[model samples]
Target: MIIFRPPKYDAIDHEKNLKESDGLKFATEIYKGQRSLSAIVEFVLSRIKNYVKKLHNFDQINKYIQGRTKTNKSKILLLTDKNKPTPLIKSIAIDYLSSFETAYITIKKNEKDEIFDFFKIDKDIAKLPQIIIIDTKDNPNEKEEIIVYDGDLNKVALSHYLSNFATPLEGPASKRMDLLNKHKNINNSQNNKKDKNKKKKNSKNTANAHDEL
Candidate 1:
């Protein structure tokens, strides 16, 4: 039996405030994608072409989604024609997709035949150029949900001029998470203070709570 390695997901430091945690920098971004199979295939193929055009060289492959998928559990597949990325770019793209050790596979046009055959994906479907992203499911099944995106290129130029500044709350996911974690810290601090004689007892609790943090 073949046992695939589990995903190496980054753990959030809930003990610290949002400002010092990984969520502030990396876990913030919108899903900005399509769920339909056909739509995603076309979307990714077009974006891959555009990503190469938008980025003429290997120096900077920067994008929002590239930064976003680094945290949390992410399973992504990058399917493209072997000829599209000129081999080197293809490898670079794969490296970029592997940000923060994301689980992914680059299914080239030629290799899809053998790979898809095992997974039982359609031949014609395999021939198309696109990416398949699986978020919640452990196995890559066609019947399962496939969430896909090519990153948000909306403010590529504007963000550059603005020194890469954006909203602190990226999307609903991060907003809710930040709020929840923020409140959790407050509650824990308050509870710890109750065990002491004065309200200023939080200093020691900070160290106590910070122990295994």
Candidate 2:
């Protein structure tokens, strides 16, 4: 059976460096070729053209949906159920969604700040995306946020920014929990064995003392 090994710290560092180098190359490519307003406009137009062309195939949309299948890709933020979402919280959530090209939100049936609450304001968002609110009670107070993007240009964003959050841990967090559980089981087993041995020893001593008497 093949086992998967996570990337080492050095490997992660190298990967980051490579990404930075690639970003610099892209910046250089744009800046080097006519660093004028017209050039910038032309670049933007080219990107739009590419985007429109890709929409016909719908590959990007499908890929984004598939990538978001997991909760991690969902990028949730769990929080305690509160009476209401503060103005500050609403602004922050909206701001995060604005950073993306498209954004959607699903609210529980009785959520304080349902999607209807934000529909009027969504027009102000440059993306002018759709928001969906699902009414599932089992999810209860769990809040979730999903952000999708290849890099800086966000493609899709979805959030169920409830008064709560939920996610399965990986990396160090998962490892620590596993170790704690293992230690607990081992300690319980050892204690049971020690108790058994102690009883056996005591029984042998009692028998020997009785024989001597």
Candidate 3:
């Protein structure tokens, strides 16, 4: 499982700072193909810098901390294959970021075996499109609490499960305003139709009264 940690700054040297961290060690292990666990570790490590950069830019990191504080829960990390098409996963991640201010990392397929071995994943369990939610707070010796699920992108159950960790935002302010305006236009059109109908009815009643007179 990927571990999400807050970024630390060391003015002395940026490369050295990242290299000395646990994230680097994990990246190195994956780079070295620890026990030949994953073939894509090198790719993951190479691209890790970009991931870190993006994470640094993420505004939800603070919310991630707040969520942990309020719920007494650990930060979340995601494990998934790099090669698999992840439109659903991407959507869920976006929603999580928008709602809860938390984002997760995706581990490529090559690293899956090692994770499975370490976590003692059952042999009968299917591998691809799997999500492993881990709570990494508290004592180091304590067994990590994990929840595993089949990675079915179309499943509402999986989406709901992820929703617990983050709230989905409607999008940018401009987009929201556009939606509001569109709704208003629709309401106005309906109201106009109703008014026209009322006028027609009144005119018919006046005509009938005149005929009777």
- Write down the RMSD of all candidates, one decimal each: 20.7, 18.8, 15.1
lDDT of 1 by residue, 7-69 (tens): 222233323443454444332223356668876555544433111222222122222123332
Tell me the spans in candidate 3 whose CA falls farther than 4 Å from its real position. 1-78, 98-112, 136-144, 170-213
Give the alpha carbon lDDT tens digit for every residue of 140-182 in model 2.
3554333312122221122223212321122222345568879
Per-model lDDT:
0.39, 0.34, 0.48
Per-residue error for 88 in candidate 3, Å, reads 2.1
Looking at model 2, how many pairs of residues clash? 5
**Best by TM-score, which number?**
3
What are the models' TM-scores? 0.26, 0.29, 0.36
Show where candidate 1 strays beyond 4 Å: 1-74, 82-104, 108-110, 137-213
| Best candidate, lDDT | 3
In model 3, state the lDDT of residue 17.
Answer: 70
Query: In terms of TM-score, how similar is model 3 to the real structure?
Result: 0.36
The residue pairs that clash in candidate 2, if any, are 78-164, 78-165, 79-164, 79-165, 143-164
